[model samples]
Target: MDEIIDFESLKLHTAAGYIRASNRCFTCKAKRQHCDYKYPVCSNCAKNNTDCMAWAKGSKSPIPRSIACYLEKRVAQLELEAHRLRTELNPEHLDDKENIAANLSSKPFSGVCNSEKDDIGDESFGFLYFRSSNLPAPFDCTLHSSDRGNIRTFMARNPMVDIYSIPSKIADIILQNYLDIHLPQYPIVSSEYVRELKSSVFEKRNTCGPYEKAVMGIILAMSTATLSYKGEKGALASSGALFSYFLSQILQVEWSDKLKKLQILLLVAHYAFSNPYAADSCYAMKEALRISVEMGLHKELDFDHISPLIMQTRRRLFMVCMNMARHVFSVNKRMFPIPSELISFQLPEAVDDHYITDSGIDLSGPPTKAAAIHFYRFRLYETEIYDVLWGHKSIKCGLKEWVQKMSNNLDSWLSEANHFSTINQLKYRAICHASGHVRLYSRSPRKQWRNREDALLLMESVIKCLDEYLVNASTGWLAYLMAGVFHVEELTVCLLDIMWNESNWIFDHYSQAYISTQVIQCIGLLQQFSLRWPDIEKSKMVSYLSNLHLKITSQLEHGFVIDPHIISQLNFLIFPQVSTGYGLDSLPEDTVDLDHNFIQMQQWNDNFTSSLSIL
Candidate 1:
């Protein structure tokens, strides 16, 4: 080497010097300051140990490079001493012995680098360390060392597994923890923030199929609406508006056409009763023919699988639609009249012809089929004609005259409903219409009626039909709607007066034996209203209240033995009164209040049941 670079000098000048340790034990020789040790090994042993060993071995050992110069000087000195001794003793053998020693003392060859092997081992140890990955990142994210350390420990212990391998134990813990924390804060996962969380998780997992995701998104949106609408009126309207926003988002992001169409139809059907405005979605929903054509889609959405609770919700939703439409129709009919020629006959003749046949009219007669041609036709056309006739005097007069003449001829068909069987059909259809009307009608008061007289007539006919239809009726949803209609007026009064009033005698004999959970809840709430009724009304209205008290007492006593109806339940516990719990942070603090009414309600019911038991 031009400069004869030393290992010591190189170590001192290197960039790695900052990280170097100068620890010397029994091997490489360096000075006190250079050696990283509490007690330094002396320079003789550290620097020349290899050469000293080689010299001591004479002809048997080879010199090491680290001390080669020092070893060579020593070897020369020894050879001189040997030559002098040989001259004193036997000079002849000296040359041969010295040559033999020179031949034996050759330098040993060394491998490239012994230290590199140790570096590789250390690197492998670091690469395998768990803390180097998940733990270190989280730790570095935090400013405080202690905080970082704690979080690092947590993450190290709870590494995220692949979504497919989500253990039941982990899932349970996560669900409980999530519910315990977020249920109160979020209340509804459909909120923008929570949905973002769901979306983020979904993306990261990459586990959900496109169709599944689309279905899941729709389910999430609908569930949010359903939960929110529980205690509110105009539930469909409120839900429909929210769903439209969900639809807007889904339409843009979700590309699976089949799922997209099915989801749209569901949204439409879901809101159909509540928001006729949702009918505007028909522009998109006509694609339902293509979207939901698969048999699997029907299986996934079977009416048979619909729960009692959902059935009730749907029936109520339908009732709202029908009632709203019927009320609107009644109003339009009262306001105006259109000419007979202008009315469209949309009902099929077979269906139209049945009404006339039932009305005891022959289709052969020129006068008209009394049921189909006169009453049914009149009923359908009257509203539209009246709408047209509102501004025109001549049309109004002519419409009025026509309506009167039509009414006279229609008496026979209209009166046909006076028959028991016919009355039942009319009542059934009217209730169905009432249910549907509740969805479409606007809230503005324009002399609207609940059609109390017609409702009372329907209720009377239902009671008459009950014994015959009881078993069959429970299977269908119509009875639930009928129950809802009967209870709506009572519900209004109970809310206004803050007390329950006894329903008429028909309810007493109706029996809870065939009652569905929806019916039971309606009864339970009404019963609760009676117990919580105003104290002022209690003493003064004792005679009026007697029936309610007796009815409740008798039912509670006999409910197990006679009716055994399972009451529809509300999960009040999930939505609690506590602050700093799930979903509560998002709720206004002032809105939290204690419910003491139910305690008294339960007490009263228990007392009444006990007294009845004694009797």
Candidate 2:
């Protein structure tokens, strides 16, 4: 027993005159060997000249605390490296889409999922884009079987929708509304064709196709809902009430023709732009996007075998789908999925639907509804601008030279036929003109602006759009609906930056004079548009524009330079909200047009600016 005890004591002796350490290197832990109790560098690591890092796994709490902590940190490092490798390996990532070595200047249109995101100590989670474009589900087979647990599609139905067989007198009102309001905005469906068809359909309600009835009901509902002004009940509720009746008729219809179904959905989505009333509008817009893509509307396809009328309708409908989808995603603040480059479809011929037949198209007649031809052309050009800006994968799009070139391209298109010889011609031309300038105005706030003269032109263009709306109140509402009012607020904020914040491109006395005059005219024009379209008064966009126009113009009038801190305060007024839009689209008749809350804030800015010395 004494000999055994002495042998155990000799075997348990501490190495190198050190007590047993509570920690061990990963190599010793793995090899099942004892580690030297040493600091800075363990005796085993020093002797072998190896790393003293720890990487161990244990379910029991008997493992050394140092090894456990080191393993925890090592696991985190491995996770970070894994994430980086995943990001680098992801070909669909916007950064690596072009080539392995290529560097893109434009940020990924938005953020990415955890695997692709840059690591910042763990927390990364978001949407993942797995396709090059908005292709159909049939084309995108990358999703795992387990990932696609279920599918939820929005479908509206109402059996009682047949009750809205509008009387002839009401039919007359609805038809005129289509001609005056709907035609200018869409112009895809022919007014004469629809008018004659509605009469025939109403007469033969028992015999006509469900698609025809559905089409007629949707158009009439959209027109009437647009023309009707609900005072305090909110435009959304009023439009929702109006749409509930028509939608029931729509959903109950047996839709066999896929193209017809797409057209009806586009119509509903278009109405949502003017009055985003219900969820169906948003769903209809999304479905339209999907159907148009699957049907190959965005891609060039051989359609010579199709009928002439059907061909033209396809072209017009696809254009409406592109523009309408953009507005939907933009307002909802979702990253738009449909890439601009995928659009290769040709514009429809400039002629009436009556002139087209099963054999071919003829543009010889005096067609009154050719406004859509021009609108489609504009949308095509807009797509070109988007693509051209993003054409060079390595370049930034906010450059002034590129913007000026694009703006010139638009002007050249409008310069082809500027004469407002007809109401249809005038309405579309003004819309295209204002839309082009607004596009320029949108780019003004990025980095360094182009020039004050260009800024002045953009401001005049906005005012000019409002002027047209006022001049042709009957159909001028088309211009009001085309571009909307969000950009106006954003552009005014740019104007404030140029006039005071930057202090570099300071407007000359003459420039200041015209800017102030145009600024006031812009507000005045909006106030006038407010009388007809209450959204002009109800939007925080217009409120910010009005108040900023007041404050910024005063600084110009009184010759005051803005302070940095004050500029920040004014800029904070917009923030994340301006990107989506402002307040309610429509307001009560008794609702005060002015933003009284903003007025008090502007008064505060006025006082602060008042104390500053003149330049």
Candidate 3:
């Protein structure tokens, strides 16, 4: 070897038959901390349990101490990221505020809109994470770890958690919260089982069977997610983690039947929702979809031996999975989801689980009590406008004909849902828009210009519905519903895009009065979203909308010349990183290669299901 080069810019000095290297290690140098630089490791790195700099470079890595330090450092980094995440997610952070984000005072365009300069800022968040200071706090993330190594080393320390118990009182709260909060998102489980679980927990002195305990653990994880969101995650900060561990343990049981195993997978997916970044639930979601297809829930008459009650439950589960699967198949991701036509199961009854029977159900005058089963029923009725307009192997007809057909169906839905509450009306309308927004966004540049008017209406409907829905909504309730949709940001991008260039089209059909009102409403809604979701700040959504607000107020009103740079920034779509890096991150376009692949997969699935029907 030519003078063995290693050790972070090592300097060897030979004076009177002695060689000396810098005492500081690479990590210490980067962090501006002192390093002892011991052979194969540093004393400070060993004490702190961080990866030694010498080991960072794999070539002739540091000794065993370096390996131990590296693993420890990773764990520390994870814990630090988790603990600090919740505090940073506080809706009322110091920097973000009310009054249409006045705190976001960094301007993107300096020369333009000097009259309305005060309102805008360089608060560009790429898509999800914002460029902000990484604040530290207590560990408020899901999956509570108790032991610095105590409760943390659970699987290695304790092989099984068959008898994990909390006070019956707390268990009761968790069950209720699960019913109220978690069920709305995933109404797969039966309410009767939960009732029985409570009775067993209380009467048997909190000693429950493995299955009941598993249910309790998963529910506890979801309920405490709310607590963490509210910043009330005191000692139970890691309760979610502990309970998740329990659920995972339950999953490994040899006796877990097929249905029970599938349920556990869904429950795991449900718990994964607490993370709020990336599609953490995607793998479990896909697994659940696979199992549902294997069980033949996609076929209406395949399971003749199964009781109607069991069949209905399976139908509900499979239909819900299909709904999740459709959304999960995004740009660049691939999956073979069950097609809508192949899915011919009866819509599961909306009645409570207890009220449902093996033979039949009574629908006495009006059928008021709506349960999770109603979600599938509702979707089946409307048939998802997006699916009709541009679904897998969509109807090969004139686009106008199908568009009119879907529009007529929407009219029918409005007529039927006339009895809906004021808030429910707003909620449903917003949802309908969410379903159709992709279609509303024009893919071709020509169609983009052609569809500007309809797209504007879509934006208006989304914001208007959201505005009314937020009238008196609490944070917990908001989290329950809003967790699923990102309509606000999507609308912001569309409106900002329209404002950037389509002024001619806008003013042609609509008046100055209309344009001004829409911009103001968009700004207001974006501000609300920024306050509600921390990701809004990081993604730089409000920044783009604020620019729109400025363009309208200053350039449109005061006759200031609009700058090309502001338009460029809005379309640039590249936001800053926390320190000094930037990258191209964006929402998926209307169509992708995967979408066509999905169509091909749909054909295969249709053939597969047709063959199964013959069997």
Candidate 4:
């Protein structure tokens, strides 16, 4: 065999054998190319700048039965030991017992996966996975993770000043303003509580704890800030200083007392809604919901065993919590934190504060009906509608059927509104009707006559609502507060959307003018709102409306017979682009002139393209 064999031939033979062996790395395999059989990494993988994974010999062949069985047994034993150790280390790791039960009821795994013949895994693993799926998502997990660090930093940087520096008479006046204006609408705290705080603060009594004082201070600050105008600059400054002081104090508390913390949060959230610092209201609502859940307010309780006063208090707190959650969700378009299915409590009884006493509620007392109860019920119905509109449930019916059902429900709700005779009730009913119209319009086909009619009607109703609110504002504070929080921004958005529907053949010059005028009216109302609450951050909404207005007006200026293509191309040029820093003061100067040449060129190109198409 020592016969002379050529070296080149031998090397070629070896390479051919290697290629036939199919021992390429993962990258080469994926690329479907021949590998150099290099150690660590193949040549093709290296050249291509990819990770190379070596394939094991005979990996495609199934393992022997004996070895597979042994491996499976070993894995099972390891998993069991790990689970046991975990259980020992943290016995209460699965503390959400109700959630577990719900999961088990909803998603029970068949025993086939882990029958006597095959031991796949423990049931706990499946439950754990299911629970994880049901847990609150990142955006929805607003409670557990808050802006406490930021708040702390703010407090550290801005040292609080003495709130008592304001004149006692002015302070009392502010407190009374809040009670008269905001209390009728909110009623989160009892009048007795306010009176007590007022007496203590006026007398300079230290009987009130820091938390109570903080609550009172923030209430007064919110009231003063909302009711006052630019003319009362000094009072506004004092209110701001008082708010910071109280907020700093409130931030220092550990928030261990659930009820007290909830009360404080509600007041803060209300203030935030009225002030420039409205962004934190969602976080406050989330925290409030968390506290309500912890206190078992969502769950139905045995009223017979509990005191009537405590029961009523719990119901009222839960309802308020729901209202706040609904408001935040509606505005942000975020997933609601509290599921309605989980709520088992009933609506709060329509009773006056005098019916409640230190001993207990006077259950035998005559039910002094109030508009607030109707308001609460309306909010509850609103929440249900919101859930149906936005929730993940599958609707088997057609759009018309769904719309009809919802409309019927809304009509039923309105029918009951006649029973409530107060001005607030009338206003609330009008708002509800306006909201229903908007909701229906939102869900309906965009180009339909019904949708356009709904949009027009909504704008009209909203205008009326605004007019009534503004007129009533002169009479009391509730109207002003309601107007401040009213969903005018929503109406503005709807009007803009209607204008943007270029597909609607029905859209004409008159329609454009009318919609544009309505939009301006809405913006004008918002401007009035900004005037009323100058410190509040409404520039964003105002800026958006302004930009929309500019767009609509520009379209109108161009006339309707112009080529749609040219209009489409020139649209961006007509309106000044808004930035995130958009404000009344920071608005960009008109750029229509700067883009004149560009628009002319676009028009020329459009004419050229149209001529070519004709040819």
Candidate 5:
């Protein structure tokens, strides 16, 4: 600069020039290409848009150093920092940083992760370790090693050791009770076979295998339970436990005869209908359908070569299974497991137990046989009605026409049923009428009528059916069980809906005293049932009925009239309210007459009125 040298004209030439060495410029050296040593720039660097820095000889080089040394230094510094963090976080592992990193990566994460500062302790170190590591942590297990071992051991133990063997006399008593009470409705096992089993000696009485024994055990337990065995509490608990254990055994065993397997399943389903806790009937019916298919029970058999009793038994079993399956599906609103097209068997023969001899079933048995046949027909019609109502199948007509047709069918079924014995006919007819009322009640949400006459009629019919059932409940344990367990809840629900919900227009036509009296009578009937079967207290229905009874009694005693607002509040406490089409404005004027005998409440009313007189 002092000499005023022309820096623009200055050329830094290498010793190997005029044919310049490629190493004269940085770009030329990196590319290993020839460079034209032009003033202030080289041709290759200029063409490639690269910085041209010439290397100085015997002086410090003008090029910068590589970043590899700086990167190594920074990595050393990070390692030292990580060691310090590990020592501060986990002082126990300060001797081995590598092991600390491995343990941190392997530890399971137990809390949420965030970037915010945490309390300075082991927890903070855990956060730091998680942030530093890129590995996924495992979840904390709930079961301890010893607990898992215990479960394995428990499952591996022999289940047969838990079998509860009842004395032959007690078993016979229970079986006899079942035969007298439940066999008429569920007639899968032959009466003759049961008698044979009962009369045979203890050592030689092993007519059935483990599955059949288990089935017999469950039936006996159910029968004893329904009868409300007043024996020692230990005996009752043992019987209940025995039944559960036997059912578990039955579930474990592989059945060989499909008919017997289906019989067990159907019996279980029937038990479920009467008992509160036996809600697995649907699952059992599903399995029964699967087994039925495997055994080809849906196909019509060649009866020419088969024994008539066997053929009849097969048909009856199939029909009962179908009916039960239909009932389960209808209650749960599930699709039927088997398609209708697959079923080809006819209805069972109209033969009585007396005619079902060792030889064959007498086709021309007693008139009761006709009654049984009519009963089966009613059940079949019930299944069809359920299908139509639930939309499982399509109907050609509208809802009104379909309901009318079904109603006509029910009437025809009742007329045919009347030709049978009086007791059986009345019972079956009551069941049919009750079913019709239930259907109408179920459909009331969709179908609207200005008049409350239909609602009144339905209530009367349901009450009449209840009265009939209650009157008969004393005759057999089946009636008692059905009334206390099933009908009580149904009638109570219907009565409450009729009394409380003004939408039904029941209170519009009747006075508050009349409706209160009706409710009191219904409650009295429930009280009578509860008194008859003290064991009904175990049922969920009993709890609901108890609460409902207390509420109604308190209200009627306090002279509270049934109002819409009060009922709406009470509805939430009693049961879930469903939306119906009838409203206050839609109610018609009172035009109906109350049937005094509908509820059989004459004696109940007299007693209540006399009590009030005394008070």
Candidate 6:
């Protein structure tokens, strides 16, 4: 027993020494080991600027409390520094490239503005691309199983949607991808997806059957509703009312009604996604409202059973009508002169269902409620696309003619000399001119005339009116960008026409010619607006011009080479006027007349005609 106790005491002493030795800095701890001695640190630690704490024979270094704490604090600081460096390197911070890189070698906080956003985490999660020009198969395949769980799982893995974020030019690619990739095996969308869409409508309702029933009614209505039909007349009144209800909900901004309608439409789309006109419910709803409005059905529609899909359909239709009205106003303002005394028409009872409040409220009072109805009416007008460059040429022409006739004697009607004039009266002159020009331009070239000076005056007036209107009216009232783009186009086209025709004649007249050339250059900047918005039809026109340009250059180089003698004679006829002012002898006195222009114009016209004949 005494011998065992002595052995235990010796083992305890050896353990205590081992722990003490392990707890020292490298130089102190490796006293027995072969760590090279150096001043202030071990040779390895001196080179590294750190205490060597790596594992040694038989054990990891038992770091000293003071030294361990100091090292821990330093490690934390270094980790923070490294994190900042990595952040600077990350592509997510590209928006702050100039600042991030400048401070990269410097301290994180130095020279960096506190207000700067250093990090912008990804919000879009993911997206796919399909270029507009690419010819690819459509990806329209679905998951093989119709089970709700399986379909939801598949969508979670790879959600399908229209590429609305991309340019519409590339929308075709997305559509094609959908057709090719997902449509084959997974043809039918599960009913569960359709049911999921039900949430977009009718949230507070106690029951939701009327909502679905209303949706079905709208689908049947869209397929069968007609203007002459009335419910009592046995002409599918349910469908017409459904159509009317949808339009009213949209125009009135009835969100509850819209959601209900949306669910029905989604179900329709789900069932008939492959149908060409499956998604046309909105279009039909739009048509219904437009026709109703045209017929002046102010209060003759019902909306109690409006569905969500029908509501969307009506909204789209309302937008289309507004767009049409805008096109009319923009292309030819005279056709839709902001009316002075707009006739107040009573809408039929069917059209009177208010989506904004309890349907029980009576609105049969005087024109006091006129302001309320008028507010929604203006929305119909506001959706007018101001920058669209392509549409019905014939309609635009007709509109131009209408404006011309309406504003024929504007001086008599709009003269400031009238003592009877009010503030609005004085404003009508500018309004009339602006609206007239917009309407005129919306039409065909048949209405196009050579009155560049008059058009310029109208365009200038428009700019002035727009400026003043911005100051006086509410911010949301004026379409500043639209007005600017339109004014730019108007001013530019006038200048371009002048420059194109008068370049050769006035090119040498430095003062006048310089002005003309400068105008042409200015027009180039305005033309850039064409690229800011998307319009397939207008884009096609631009593409056509580009192609034609190449074709013309090719032809000019290889074909239709001019005779040297003709060129010389032409120079003699035209160059003298430019160089020595001698060609003034050849120009006719009646140069301002059409006859003079005809002779010069014939050259280009003949070229075009010849080209067409050859083709």
Q: Which candidate has the top score in TM-score?
A: 4
TM-score of each: 0.21, 0.54, 0.56, 0.59, 0.52, 0.27
Query: lDDT values of the candidates?
Result: 0.28, 0.47, 0.44, 0.50, 0.47, 0.30
Model 3 spans with C-alpha error above 4 angstroms: 1-185, 205-211, 220-256, 268-279, 302-304, 327-336, 355-374, 377-384, 387-397, 414-446, 451-456, 469-476, 480-485, 505-615
Best by lDDT: 4
lDDT of 1: 0.28
- The clash tally of candidate 4 reads 0
Can you write out model 1's per-residue Cα lDDT over 1-615, one digit (the tens) per residue? 122324554344333332222333323232223333322233455555432221111122222222322222333345345434422323465334223222111211011011111110000000011111111111111121111111123233323223324354533444343333222211212122334445454555465443434333333333333332233223323333343343333434433243334433444433322222222122122223212222122112234665533332222222222222222333222221112232222221221121233224244532111222222433343343333332222443563354344334334444553342332223333332332222112111221222333234433433333322333233322222212322232222221111111123324533433222223433443333223122112222222223333444465545423321211001111111112122311222222101112112222233222211110
Model 5 scores a C-alpha lDDT of: 0.47
After best superposition, candidate 2 residue 180: deviation in angstroms? 7.9
lDDT of 6 by residue, 32-120 (tens): 56555332245566566665542224443333322222322343345345434444444565456333323322332212222232322
- Which stretches of model 4 miss by more than 4 angstroms? 1-89, 92-173, 225-239, 276-279, 358-360, 363-369, 392-429, 443-456, 465-486, 502-511, 525-545, 556-615
- RMSD after Cα superposition, model 6: 29.9
Off by over 4 Å in 5: 1-181, 199-209, 219-254, 302-310, 332-339, 352-372, 392-405, 411-429, 441-445, 448-450, 469-487, 500-505, 517-615
| Candidate 5 residue 39 C-alpha distance from true site, Å | 88
Candidate 5, residues 151-231: lDDT per residue as tens digits? 112223313224336676766677877676456556667666566545542345555556655666666655665554354
TM-score computed on alpha carbons, candidate 3: 0.56
Alpha-carbon shift of residue 68 in model 4 (angstroms): 59
Error of 6 at 522 (Å): 8.6
TM-score, model 6 to reference: 0.27
Candidate 6: worst 10 consecutive residues by lDDT? 129-138
